[model samples]
Target: MYDLPSEFPEEPGLPDEFHDLQPQLLSRTLRLTAYSQENWFTGTDLNVYYDPTHVLWHKRPDWFLALNVPRLYNGDDLRMSYVVWQEQQPPHVIVEFLSPKTEREDLGRFYRAQDRVIDPRADQFPPPLAPVNTPPSKVEVYEQYLGVKHYIVYSRYTRRLRYFQLVSGRFQEQTLQAENPRIWLADLDIGLGIWQGNFEGVPSAWLRWCDRAGNWFLTDTEAAQQRAERLAERLRSLGIDPDDID
Candidate 1:
């Protein structure tokens, strides 16, 4: 029942240079130490279908992470789109990269701080249906319909990050430090925070994951370079220069 087409005639996401690299950094650094790699799945610019009734009503999040779901669809082929009901899992966390066209909706311009109530239970899923033609904003989809535990939005232009956690079936915004902002999700034994560094040779503040120790997780390339550096140091200690090798 979940065999939904992933793409449409008109693509939904607004992608630029930052859009391309930011999601890559998120997925690459999302290391859940407690869960095996195969037990977790992360999607980049992938369609997430929320309503089984309105199969086409979906959101294409910048990046989303679902836990305890097979890396492959049904342990078979790659998923064209994430059908929430079919997978029997809502995204544990969803992230959106704010752009000029999306910030208002992403930050829920519809509601104010006094309007929402904070709830500790974040289990509101299978939300009431909206008119197929008149769908809610992106934040509503993730906060209300999907009941995603964590909702993160970041703006590269402003170097500002916003975090919302689903509490008592409603999403409540969290306070963040002005510098070295971090969030610790006990459920995943992982934390996400802003890191100021050069990635792929571009110096900028990027959202990255960290362990309980607050050490940022490295991307595959960074890990490889780290290993090579350790090996070079070992070789030098043995009176052999790794750089001298052909």
Candidate 2:
């Protein structure tokens, strides 16, 4: 059902500066959020639809999030793509990596203008200005319109971060506390920040590795596995062994 246009130019692959690190950053951030919250979903590079037209579309953020949904689809697997029209909900947050090509769209004005010219099938898509009691804040509108909350724009070029939150039908920029390098999202009770560390002897900003003390970096699934193993070992040490029960 989801197909790219033949006339649509080939998706320019992510530039060398962004190809690897950006994905890793997005993945780790999503993992951090999902691990810390319940009934919340986080994804990277999943399809997302905001307008009813489904005609105007964008493919996944560096990372995106939806709150109050099953962490797993059907209780097992993560979602591959989010069709806002199909899903009927907006993501609570979105993160956009700054690249020369897409900084404008992520900032809101670009997509808004593009959406204006889209000639949406009104029947298929709701009127842009249809009044709703709780019209999202400008930032929230990005979630409502783009199905993303807490729009995050990060500049690899500058290593700087900017975050916006939806409030009372408008967007407001949030400033970070000097003590905390992470951006705080009160909605999710979590924070996102760059971590400088070593992984497999390669210095990388977003690495998923564990230390001897059983503390871990950003390996989501791996962290779960480690937790399970720790529990099993603890049970055995207490003589409440699974083998004995069997």
Candidate 3:
């Protein structure tokens, strides 16, 4: 089992710890109000095969969501990978968390740009594109081939979120409001926003799902804790010392 990794050796660094944690947060809080849980699927670090013509070519997105698909692959086994042709559906949303190695590819920039020392071209835009024969970039695969409707890029370092929507066969960057950067995906009937809280015993801002009213969904552990607290309070109200019994 250890022989084959979901993210091949070629992919950078095999992803960091935050990569593992962030996608878990997204998966836990994801409540597809538009469809039944049995009808949708989500994958983290899953290799998605897009082009049937070039069967070997694939893109490994950090996280992706697909609608009207089986919760389990073929309603039984967990998916090893997602094949677009076999599934007959492309992902509705794709999210990438920025890393130093993948920032340029994920952001569709010709040059790497982050804080600290730089050589030249402080404010210059992207340069020319590579030849068609070369392997397509992540953005190119998502935008042109897969045609993902909603593309999100987030930076944990800066706590910033960037959104892109497909329009007229092209990906257009959406302007996030200065005050409220939270995005409400109306079609999915679920909102995604950053919340500052404790998760997995760590306190930090996490990308989580919320309702239109801005209430973040509780995770399994959180829900369980809430239930236990309510039970304890009820016992106290009934004049029973819960701590003594447990």
Candidate 4:
């Protein structure tokens, strides 16, 4: 067994407010009717170790889901990181929130030549002799290494969502329904779309999960609020003051 890295380098920087709240929303609303809670695991900003040969290499996704995996490591301990070799299960869906710093890498725009040379003196030889320092982008890691099935990217600034599905061993960009801005995941029996409204007291377009019927899944707080509203409505119909009772 390969020993996991105990001290990984600190991330470049911390995420902003939107980054923190958005993933919370996704984690809270994700519900699979068919699969029990124990059958899946959701992670946010967690290291996902993919390559066994290079155990140090990892990607920290904004949010990801791994089906048929215990929520805890070995069904007991919480996972420090999701090791692909150890878990033997890759994420089924991965979501990325686009920011200025990660836009190009998230979109797989960076490429490193396979035959790049390392010696500085080789610069006199040709362009191919120059050392390539570019590492694999998030897209490359998901598509080639982890083989993630669904890759979704949402831009809060543009209010645009891009969906890609792994088909025939490659990721194909999916077309969105112009009438309704939502991408349906048949396998998961849910859809993802940009919802505009106040979430956690901040009003903006946020990424959220929707059911097959196009109903937005509610977070725990939202669900509780809805229940209270329904109770208040029922009390009013019976000519009782709900506020006064409480």
Estimate TM-scores for all models: 0.86, 0.58, 0.87, 0.84
Residue 168 displacement in candidate 4 (angstroms): 0.5
Worst window of 10 by summed lDDT in candidate 4 = 110-119
The model with the greatest TM-score is: 3
Candidate 2 Cα misplacement greater than 4 A, ranges: 1-9, 12-21, 24-40, 54-56, 71-80, 108-144, 178-180, 199-202, 206-246
Candidate number that wins on TM-score, 2 or 3:
3
Error of 4 at 171 (Å): 0.6
For candidate 4, the lDDT comes to 0.80
lDDT of each: 0.81, 0.55, 0.82, 0.80
RMSD of each: 7.9, 11.5, 5.0, 7.7
Residue-pair clashes per prediction, in order, are 3, 8, 0, 0
What is the C-alpha local distance difference test score of candidate 1?
Answer: 0.81
Candidate 1 clash pair list: 119-167, 119-168, 120-168
lDDT of residue 83 for candidate 2: 56
Tens-digit lDDT string for candidate 1 (75-185):
988778898988889999988886544555667853444423333342442333344467677888898888999998877766777888999988888998988788888
In model 4, what are the clashing residue pairs, if there are any? Answer: none
Model 3 lDDT per residue over 196-219, tens place: 998888888889999999999998
Model 3 ranges with Cα > 4 A deviation: 1-7, 109-133
User: At residue 41, what lDDT does model 4 achieve?
Assistant: 95
